[model samples]
Structures are given as C-alpha cells and as structure tokens.
Target: MSKIIDLIKAKEEGSKPFISIEFFPPRTADGVKNLYARMDRMKESINPLFSDVTWGAGGSTAELTLDIAEQLSTTGHVANMHMTCTNLEKGGDPKAAVRGALETAKKNGINNIVALRGDPAAGQEEWKAADGGFTCALDLVEYMTENFGSEFGISVAGYPEGHPNAISEVEDPSSMSEAEKARSSMEGGKVYTCRDADYKKEMDYLKKKIDAGADFIITQMFFDTKVFGTFVKDCKTWGINCPVVPGLMCINAYAGFVKMTGFCKTRVPAELRAKMDSIKDDPDAVKAFGIEFGIQMCQDLTEIGVEVLHFYTLNLEKTTYGILKGLGYEVKGSAWARVGDQVKTANGVGVVKSIESDGSASIEFEGETPTATFKKEEYSKVF
Candidate 1:
C-alpha cells in the first residue's frame, strides 16, 4: 500500500538509518521455498525498508521475479521489482513482454520498480537492443512514466564505478584522475576504469532517468566507501537530487569476491585485497574478515549521511546479520511499528502516523482521522 519513495521521504531528518535487502530467484522450487522462509525471518528480525527481486539476465527469471515480488508485497514488505529491456522477441512488438510484466506488478499491488538495461543473454558477448525496442534504462523509465503515470515509484541503477561496458582497459594508470584511479580494477595484469568521458555520459544518462520520472537510484556494489561518497557528491554536481541508495554486496567467501569483482571490474582497495589473499585458504577467516571489513565500510557510509544501507544478500543472511550486530543494531527481534508501516486495525487500514514509547501507534486512515492510537495487539502490519 506504500510506495518505496514515500517511505524513504517519510524518514525524519536525523533518525536512525534503515536497511533494504535484495534477493535473486533461486533455480529450484525447494530453494525458493527456503528463500521465502529466510525472507520472513529477516523481516521479523531486522525489518528492511524494502525488499528487491532481481530480474535475471535477458529477463530469464521474469515469471519467478513477479511471483516473489507479489509474495513480498502481500506479506508486508515493500517490493521493488526490477524490470529490464532484455525481454524483446523476434519480429514482434518488442515491448509486449515488458508491458505484460508491468501490468502484472501493478495488479499485484506492488508499487515500486527498478528499471534497468539488463545483462545480455547467456552465450552473448555483447548486449543488443532488439530493433524497434527500447535501447536503455532511460527509455524504460520514460515508457513507465508515459504508461503508468505516477502509479509506480520507479528507480534506476547507478554505477559508482561506472557500468562494466563503459569501463575499459588502460595501460597507464598514471594518467587517470584521482577519482578514476581510486575506482580502477585489475584483471589479467591490466587496469580498468570508466574514463572521465564515459563517467560523464553515465551521469548524464542517470540524470535523464530521474527527469523521466524515476524516483530514486540503487547503486551497483563497490567496496570502497570513498568511491560511494564521491559518487553522491558527483550526483549533486550533475543535478541528480534524489535518494541514492548504496548497494552493499556482502563478502561472504573468497572465490565469490574474486569472481564477482573481476566480472564487474569493481575496484578493491589494495590492503583489502592483500588481506583477502592472505586469508583465502581459511573459510571461517574469510567470512570473519568480511564482517569486520563490512562494519568499517558501513561506519564510513553513515558518517557521509547515507539514510539506507542496501545489502545485496545473494540469498544468504549470516554475514549481513553479523555486520548489523557489529554496528550495535538489534538483529534478532521484531522492529517497532514505524512511521511508514501500513497496518490493518479494527478501525480500518492506515499508515502509522506515530508511535509512543510504550508501543502504542497512532493510525492515520484515508479520509478519516484525528489519528487514533492503537495498542500493539489492536493492529497488525498489512500489505
């Protein structure tokens, strides 16, 4: 019943920071059931401001994404469904499938979407938009605004280190700017970064997405907190004045760290890399280091005034819990009913206008209220 953007804006200035979680569809039925259980437990423990379901490469998991999103929205989580441009079919209305997906999400009462230009299909070397179809995320944002109006709160991807396609190999790291050098990644003895020109284009494109009615941005993962801080300042320079949620990809294992950073060309601090290399052989040590490093990075982000810490859970939870607990957050109990929480009470359905120290909540019903105070037992969290 609540849009993700509304919930974000509803946060009082100087309030405690919140969390959001991202999940991908599991390949098996049993895997999905287990993921659902994990999500339910996560909600009860450390309630996230919103939950995200990724659209697989080439929209391969479209149906599953819709199903999971519906479940999350109906079960008291604000579901942010990712939609992409990879659903085009040959010689047909290129946006037919995309339109269908949007319709389904709206019908299911899911009001948030992450519009993206998705990764290419399996076995494809480069991404290509089908002829007569949308070419990029900007197009998708415009399409949604044109079709759905303000019915959905739309978000778009922001790459702190720039998109992988825009990042290119460089022989001379010496010539790169301080900002570029800090974000440079290495692969096969070569250094790579989004050159200044491409980084500007990325920023301009992001600004256009916002202009086209996208409500917020969820950034791609980066290890260095400075990289994210610089990106936020740069957004202001580019006139992108919206919430930019930093994506925190939890480092749970060494191999995943190596593989994903290499694949995305993500920047890793030299000391962080050396520490990981030293501890790579010890699984428990690697996980322990991940939590330790995550806490430090999160502390830096909080100092920079970020409102939300968005975790790419990768369908796992332990490391995330460890990091939150390290930060002195409660990781094992139900959160108090918050200002933006939607609830159904004996009086009627409404958002919580406020909450008392004793767990009493004031409910604000549509077209009705001198907001009424209700005890914890009189109302339950609603979709």
Candidate 2:
C-alpha cells in the first residue's frame, strides 16, 4: 500500500508541487458508472499524485466510499479514504464497523485515510455522540494509532479559520479583524464568529492531533490567502511542523457556489463576491472566473512555497483542467461539454446567447438582445 504521507515526504529532487484530487461517492448506480469514467479520464490527463474519496455523514456512504477507495488503490492510484468518528464503538462490546472498515481498507491495499469528526447525519441539526462510539476526531486518531501501529498514513483536517462549529456565538465583534468579521453570517442579525481566543484553542487542539501521530493535515478550503498564510505562520509558531496541504475548492456551478459559501461561512472578498453576484445568471461566466481566479490564487500559494496543491475537484473536469492549464500544468485537451453547451439559454435568468467564431460568448443579462460580449479570458467555455 502506498501511503500518502510517505509520498509527500519522499518527493524527489526537482519535483513540482504535488497535485491531489478529491471525489465523493455517487449515490446512484449510473452516477457511479459516470464517475468511474471521469476518474479514468482525469488520471489519464492530469496524473494526480493521489486522489481521495469522501465518506458520507454518519457513515451513510461508508460502503460505497470504501469500494471506490479500494478500486482506486487497486488500479494504481494512491487512494485516501475518509473515515469519521460516527458509528464507532469505544468499549463494551462496541460496534466492529470502524475496525472492520480499517481492516477492509488495509486488505484492499489502501493504507491512507483522512480521519475526521464528520458532519451530523441528514435531518439532524446538531451532532450527538453515539452510544459506545468515539466522541471526536482526536479519539479516532488515537484509536487508529493504537489499533494499526504504522500500518496507515493518517491525515487530519485543519481549519485555517477555526471550524465553523467552534465559532463563538456571543463574542465581542468590536476588536475583531475585518477579515474575521467577513467570516461570519447573519441568522437573526447576530455577528457570531471565530474569536481570537477561540482560534488559539483551535490551534492547540490541532497540535494535539499532530502530536497524536497524524502524519499530515489537509486544511479546510479558504478563499483568502492571508488566512492560509497566517495559519501556516501560526502552525510554525505553535511548533506543529508537518506538511499542511491547502484544500482548494473548485468553482463549479452558480447554485453550488452560493450553497457552499453560505454553509461554510467562508470569507469571500467583497470584490470577488460582487463579481460572482454579477455573473450569477451566467454559469459559463462563473466557470471562466473560477479558472482565472484559481490560477491567481494558486500562484499566490505557490509563492509561499507550498509543497502541494490539493484540489477539491467536486467531480468536474473543465474548470479544474482549465485552472491547471492556466497555471501551465501539462494537460491534454478535453472535449468535455458544458451544461449549457446545447441548451436554449433563453429559459434561465439570462437572454440572447451567441457563440462567436473564436468560441467567444456574449449574453444579455436581462434583455432579449446581447449587450456585452466578454473576452475569452473572462470565461471558460462559450455558452
């Protein structure tokens, strides 16, 4: 089994920043078929250093996730399966599911896993510990170390701006940084946030995870490089020195963007948010912006000498491929079709759609006639 942590540590001379991709198991049989096709296509062109499969909340997708991870590993890709603390029994004739899953992964030649305190199950507002199950991610890390003993390379999640769940609801916002203020959302007009003290405690907890023998950390996605830069600096100051891989969220569809940003309480810069809002009606424009923004964001991170560029691909190809190509990564051309490739855009939030000879696209955000034709660089595929 090829361990991801060992792969990252064993980089040879002149190696470019390591590239890793993430995918989630599909729910339907047809969706799984399509995913396999896409995965094969991605590997052929991008040749990622490794790939990850995500587990559903509360082990809902455990079987499918393990199946994909095993397939990826058996087919010669370093597959890191994600495991959560859900449904795990600590003692008293505990459920064998957790141990069984680990043994199953090992038996399938997959020796890497991302340990997590996964999100609560669907329809649950807050998470409660299961009877006889581990309480948090820390416990899970300890369990793996005790049970496996150097048999797996474990990766843990690090939130650069503290986990959203840990943010303080009653903190004084007056002394908060502008960036900190941006990381909040309004429910009934309360400015809940990740206060400084709370963030420090978070760092302390992160140290415990690393100190518990986690091999590396893959951070939660962030839009601001300063947040990540500060995180890396703080990680060093705290003496928790291990490779921290930035998890990059790929810009996919318009609806998905709003949903994720809102859910994560992610800090989107005013300018970037406004740009996204302006193009909310045009998916192609949003995708084009994603590639452009991803390229610049990646360049900024690379300048900080990050050892790896891990992408949260969200199971799409065009934007990820476009971003990599924009960054001068070797990528073959793909005939991947955009969602609006053949559709009558006459139905959605926009109007007149025209594709030019040079594959440039123009759209009228309101009227029946086009008003502005954006440059090719401003967007990805022509609508």
Candidate 3:
C-alpha cells in the first residue's frame, strides 16, 4: 500500500500526467454490484493512479463507502476514502465515529483520505456542526494529523469558482473586479460570483487546511479553463504551495449537465452552454460533444502545468472512456471474463464458473450438460 501523494511525487517531472477517477456509491444493491463490475473494468482499461469513493452526507453511507474503499485498495488501486464532519455525534462524543472510521481505514490499507466539511443530512436545510464536532475541513485535517500523526495522507477541497454556498448574485456586474468576474457565472440573465472578500476567505481557509496537514487539493469542477488557471495563480498569491488537482466532471447527458452546474453554481462558458443547449435533445450528440469538449479542456489544463486529471465519473463509463481515448490514452476494453458472466463457446452458451491463471476458464453449461474447462481462445465473454 502507498500514499497517493507518494505515488504522485515518485513520478518524474514532465512525464505523462496521472489519471485518477472518483466514484460515488449507488443507492441499491444491484447498482452497487454493477458498479463493482464497472470499476474492475475501468481498472483494467484505464489503470487509474488512484480511485476514490464519495462519502454520503452525515454518514448515511459510511459503511458502504468504507467497504468500497477497501475493495479498491485490495484490488490494486490506491483508495482515497472521503471522511466528513457531519452528524457524527454518537454517544455524546462527536469524534467517535470519525475515530472509528480512521481505524477501519488503517486496517484496510486505505492510505489516503479527503477531509471535508460535509453537506447537510437529509431534510436539513443548512449545515450545522454537531456538538463538539468539526466546523470545517481545516479542523478535520488538524484532527487527523493530531490523532494519526501522518499515518494517512490527507487532501482537502479547493473551490476554483468559490464554493456554491459562498457564491452570490452580482446585482451590478460592472462593479465587479476583474478577479471576481473571472470566477463568476451567469444564469437566467443574472450574474453570480464569489465576491472578492469571500473569495479571499475561501482561499485563506484552503491555505489553513494545507497548513493543518493536507498534502494536496482537489478542486470543485468548473467548465472554463481560464477560471481554473486564474484560481491556480491566486493560490500561489495566497501562499498555498500544495498540489491542486483539477476535478473534471465528464459530461454524459444534457439534463445531468444542467442539473450539476446549476447545483454547483459552476461557470459554464457561454459558447459551451450555447452548444449544449442547441444539442440538448440529442443524447448521442450530447455525449459526443461532451467527449470533444472534455478533450480540449484537459489539454488546456496540461499546458498550464497540471500534473493530474481527476475525473468525476458519475458512476458511469462512456464519457470518461471516450475522453481518455480522444486524449491518446490506451483504453483496453474489458478483456478479462469474470465468474458468473455469460460466455459464447462452440458448444453453445454457458456461464463462467471459475477462471484459472494461464488464460483459461471453466464453464458450466445448461440443461444437464457437463462442466468443462477450455483454453482462453476457445471461448469469448459475451457479457
């Protein structure tokens, strides 16, 4: 097991940038199972440097998140589990659940964590700190370093466009400073941006997270590369010297694009938004545009000295794969068959029962036919 920061530092400067992917836990058993298959397939294909699972609000999916993180670690991917300070007051000890989670992560070989001040729990209109709980990600970072003492590498979030909660509508766009304008977004004829003061506070808080113990930063998604570039420059101006990984959200559908950007209050460049609006009715066109746009955005990031591209996969595969393939990354389609997968053989259809080393597997046929082992070339995975 290795820390994600270590893996990153071990890479020689000016080499190909590393690929990292993020996944969120699905809400159902079947969805979870299919996600496992998809994850394994992506691991085989793109070979991400690290994979992370998002934590649900208020520990709602805490156990499931840990399980998925462990699975990722054991299956040859560096697993970065997200830990949040929300609704963790149990037995009057606010840190009890968090402490237990850290212990579990240590035992499971999850060497990195994304410390966060999480969103509100279900039915809560706003976020509030539990009694004796952390108030922000900076506090969580301090706690981890204090308790674990460098046992785990920590990364905190950076809001290139300011966090959604801090972003507000600009009553007079002309009054805004150039920096504020760069971080601003517009919707329905209203301009929105993090006012200069609030953006300074955001940057100060992010710097505190780094000083407290965070090794790196992963930013919230934004469509405009110039916004991200300016944010990076601002980070240096604020004396934040940590690595800031760009979080790229792969566009897969028109509705999802609108919903996510609206929710995050992300600044969508006018041209990109107009193109998306024009092609909103065509799903294939939307995905194709998504891939094409993602390619250009990634190239822009690379030119600006970003060493890693962290993709928010949204628990889907197509757009992410398409973008990578467009960027000249080797994407090996699923070549390994898993147990219980349907396969086609000369004899007929069968279910894979076991896979052996040296490129062979055993198949169990239907209707009283005998089970048989066949060379890898004799059968092909059908699903």
Best by lDDT: 3
Q: List model 1 lDDT by residue over 290-363, tens digit each.
A: 88998999999989988889999999887887788788776643233468877778778888888776567888
Off by over 4 Å in 1: 88-91, 333-383
Q: For each candidate, what is the lDDT? A: 0.87, 0.79, 0.88
Model 1 weakest 10-residue run by lDDT: 329-338
Residues 82-179, model 3: lDDT tens digits: 99987554456778778988999999999799999988888887888888778888888998999999899999999999999999999999999988
lDDT of 3: 0.88
The worst-scoring run of ten residues by lDDT in candidate 3 lies at: 329-338
Better of 2 and 3 by lDDT: 3
For residues 236-297, what per-residue lDDT tens digits would candidate 2 score against the true structure? 99998999999999988778887887677666766777798899999878988999999989
Please say which candidate is ahead in lDDT: 1 or 2. 1
What's the ranking of the predictions by TM-score, best on top? 3, 1, 2
